[model samples]
Target: MGFKAALSKVFAWYVNRHLNTVRQNAVALQQKTFSNLIHDAKNTAFGTDHHFDKINSYEDFKKHVPVRDYEELRPYIERVVNGEADVMWPGKPAYLAKTSGTTSGVKYIPISKESMPEHIKAARNALLSYIHETGKADFVDGKMIFLQGSPVLAEKHGVQTGRLSGIVAHHVPGYLQKNRLPSYQTNCIDDWEEKVDAIVKETATQDLRLISGIPPWCQMYFDRLSVVSGGKKIKDIFPNFKLYVHGGVNYEPYRARMEESIGFKIDSIETYPASEGFIAFQDSQKEKGLLLMVDAGIFYEFIPSDEYFNDNPTRINLKDVELGKNYALIMNTNAGLWGYSLGDTVKFVSKNPYKIVVSGRIKHYISAFGEHVIGEEVEQALMGVAAEEGVEVIEFTVAPQVAPTTGELPYHEWFVEFGKEPKDPAAFALKVDKALQQKNIYYFDLIEGNILQPLIVRSLKKDTFINYMRSQGKLGGQNKVPRLSNDRKIADELKEFIV
Candidate 1:
């Protein structure tokens, strides 16, 4: 390996060792907290059945309860909105994390006072882990910039209502909180224009060292920062900036563009942050697989990928998990979400129980034309084609659409943004077609007699997809362009730019 690559590997090994030590300490601390929570839940109105009965062992817990989705919890959310007590958890919730789901409109997920600590601890741990990984903990005491959702707290009555981001921001250390760009109680959504303007004005002279948020929003902020600073790169704005923590969705597609825009290779860390809880984070500087926080105010259960649809899905406790297998994630958080199926899939990368990589979202599977293609399958196929062709893909998306033929079946259309134009697009498409046929028999059969035609690859500009998402009001702040679409609506919407 080259000198830099070898150094990176060595540094990763060192950081991994330290990460394990910290994880062990965190687990012990969390286990005590979890035990006390279980004890408390047993005496509460919501826990008449000895709440610990079902959770005696992780395995037992998985077998007795069916996986639950957000739809099933809508009634409980209604209770919170109406100010009912002991619906999901024991007490009146302190705040709600407002989020938008695919099929559902705005949802106010309950976040109790008791559960706020989990959010804080998880978030703090994520930052600490990043510091440990990059060996930059010494430099982290500088001014840190969090490019997050607005600090506006929604209200129901005369009292201020708490949103997750707002609550967290409010509870941050006084020293750090004082340096925040916007106050926690401000109306961020309604006052976005003014807030953005204020942020530009305030940070125009600060020595900002860290940035945290989704890539799209970060890009927007950086664009503003550039404009205000005479098109200077992030290095010019924060020469000591050492880290970039990003989450929400895969940052792979936007990584190149972001780095180019920023004009520096700032160390990037990926995290799995959901309204329910902070799930996983990359602990080492190497940015290898993420380590799941086992003891963070939640009891985690893994339903084996093979058993994801079993009549009774069996749960595997955190202790019994093996390495390199995918699992449908379920969690019982202190926030009153019990046996909640997160609808996200993950796979273990090591035997150490705390580390796993997010494979994909459960509902992200594509069955266009009835081929039943999944996220992993598609990612693998694309990676394989890129490897064989010696090309690097910057971004890609696939959608199912009906071919305009006399009597043709629907097929998958691919849009690929490459770093450099491929030597031959048709040849690359043929290779991908053959790979899909070999990996998926259903796809192969459909392609043999024209039931499904060969894959079509549309070469697109680097920023085409990002611009498309922005045009649809789905870009910037927490929203991401779908990588795979089942119907033609999003596909048709994007075709204008692809062609």
Candidate 2:
């Protein structure tokens, strides 16, 4: 082997050894992280207000700091934004991750220097682990692309501020900068289509071996490449393409369409990284879950998702989390977010190594008519029926059609854009509806009681979802249409794009 490949093998081996040791002491590592966070922030404004100096255990921590979403935590964050030192973390944060929020509009999440490296390290280590297991390090030598927001940042209160992806763009390690794609000028283009056009122009003929992005944007990239190459498969355009790293959304729903775009399946890694913390990453090709980052600079607590809206939900530590039960993910991080609710839900798939599968978002679900369907159930239902029908789905969303225009019964409306439409659309809808009924008993009872009719699948025109997102100025980056909603806001707007 060449020097670079040999060196990568050695590094991957050492990193894997280090990671095994770290996860083996998961509980102790978490305890250390918790204690360090409290000790570090004891003199900060929020710390003092929450009596952090007196917090000696989880019990004290919980009693002192109640769980809070972004809006509830805004007062303290406002102080931080106004040039106040020691408001959230010590002195000041390195950057403010700007993200869209439901209640707070544009929210600024602090990222201290201490916590920034965890995000970089976890992403690196995920690749190292993959290389160690598969012995595939050649991809490191080829061009790589990560579909992300513009790297150009704006100033907020003397601190740099931008989307989390944009902020991370400023920190791409020096070694890989040579192999990274879509020149800095191209990445800074504000418009998504313009940026993709530049990316396609620059890299269409280059050797691209590794591609990373949320699946939909990657699909957009692939489609652009295909059009440029006269309808060639992605694998034909870049024959060496091997690894696909994705996160921010589940990949299964887009799998069939993406695979068709590529003309074959490829190795993939799923990561659970948020502005709050780098939570987990897929560590093994054989494992079904992403391994939790125990040594990362974050303390984790989980509240049962079912009980999340209750006045007092049961919150438990990593050691106490049970397998297969959904829980709302909470964190106290080095970034000075204490008792912060991520609004995302997850279920522990493995307790020994503390691995988890993202179940759904706490605020994004369908409970209309008492069925309480979740993201996972909807995804799995669609995935199962698609497999059985041999149809390829491009995108879909579920919303309750409560008020039928002509006085028909209420039903779940599925807006689907199919790359390969089912030969029997009604039968396809029936299969998916049945699967959802089996997954959620309440939905089955609602159907049996005649309170709701079978789900109605509205086959939409190609790129209907894309057009809708573009119209809303959310065409790319990490923006995604909600999979399920309790109301008709999205459902009503989708009427303009029906096939």
Candidate 3:
């Protein structure tokens, strides 16, 4: 090996050894911490102050306290919003991480001072694990760009209470903070459009080696980068760039677009980030899926995705989880969310507890017409059909819509964006239909001799779907194109421009 390569390898070895040791220690420490916390919570819930009141098991905890969604906690958050001392947790919330749900307009999730370190530690371990895996720690310790959300925290009495990103920025290591774009606090202001514009202008000339964010935002930013740089390849803008870190949604649709925009095959690191905590992240080597931060200040429970929210959901403890089964994740975090189901599903790819693939979201499934099609199944069908027909699908979405046929029922419609038009649209559609039928028998029953017809591949101009999302006030930030819809409304909304 060359000198630099050899040094990189040695450095990776050292880092990995250190990480393994630290992870083992952290896991032990976290287990003890979580055990005590669970006990305290159980005691507190039942009006006791003793630290060890023995609420040890999941069943015991569940029996005493019912599951709660965000709405139930809104009042406590409102107390913080009104500048109360000790709103939810013991101390005043350090910052609020803004997130949105389908029904909730905007939620300001409290970020406590005690839980901040856990987030930082999980993030740090993710980055360090990636570095060790890739043996790329020697690459100038290059600039890490975070394509983050609007940095604005809600104001109480005209004073800015920091957002999570802002708080994190303040605590960033001096070395890393100097290289971050837009600074942390400045980015937290609610005006994301202006912030994105500033980010594009300022970083147009910098040598960014790493970029991390939701896929849609990154794609949009790179598109703007292309225009600002007068059609320069994204690589040209940051020639030393080595990796792109993305998560928050299924990335298959955006992968080709991102590669085409960047003009290179860049390494990607996917993560499972949520307002509750940073759950897991891709290792530096880009091998396998992300490694769950088992040592982070959280205890995990996996309920089978199919059985989630059932009258009696069966949950697998951390030790009993198996490989290759999809499970809805339930987390008990140091941030005060106990037995909270974050609504995302994952499947383990390895027996080692840390490695798993984010299968899809619980809410992103389509079963409107008795066809229970999931995100992974749809992606697989699309990929399979594309492979068989030798076509490249840039982006796609499937929606169950009521087709006004002469004495017929509604069917599922697929809106697809391809690099170019296919030779035989009908044959391509048939292949996808059969694939879906064979891959998922429930879908077959729904389509056989029923109103639900074969899959429709409404090929559109490149970036058409993304443009539609941008037009809908759901792009360029945390918003993304929904992969699967229960009805055809969203697909119909985007159809006018396809032809």
The candidate, 1 or 3, that scores higher on TM-score is 3
lDDT of 2 by residue, 419-447 (tens): 88999999999999999999999999999
Worst lDDT run of 10 residues, candidate 1, spans 1-10
Clash pairs detected, candidate 1: none
Clashes of 3: 6
Where model 1 places Cα greater than 4 Å from the true spot, the runs are 1-37, 43-46, 49-64, 138-141, 157-163, 182-205, 227-231, 369-371, 376-396, 402-409, 415-424, 428-451, 459-473
Model 2 TM-score is 0.98
How many residue pairs clash per model?
A: 0, 0, 6
lDDT-superior candidate, 1 or 3: 3
TM-score against native, each model: 0.82, 0.98, 0.86
Per-model root-mean-square deviation over C-alphas: 5.7, 1.0, 3.8
Q: Is candidate 2 or candidate 3 better by lDDT?
A: 2
Question: Model 3 Cα displacement at 252 (Å)?
Answer: 2.3
- lDDT (Cα, 0-100) at 149 in candidate 2: 90
Instruction: Kindly indicate the candidate among 1 and 2 with the higher TM-score.
Output: 2
Weakest lDDT window of 10 consecutive positions for candidate 3:
43-52
By lDDT rank, best first, the candidates go: 2, 3, 1
Q: For model 1, how does the per-residue alpha-carbon lDDT over 387-434 read when each residue is reduced to its tens digit?
A: 667677766778876765666566788887777666988898888879
Q: Write the per-residue lDDT of candidate 3 for residues 1-499, one digit (tens) a residue.
A: 3454455566557757866664455445456656755643443322132222546655665565444566765665676666665334454566667666655677766666666787776666566666666656544355668877655455663334544555565566665676677655547645555667778887888878888888777877888899989999899998888788787887776677688889898877777767777788776463577777666667777888877758787876566677888898887765556656677788988644357888877777888765667888888888777766767777778887665557556766788888755689889888888888887888888778674777767777777876787676665556667788876668878777575
In Å, residue 194's CA in model 1 sits off its true spot by: 7.0
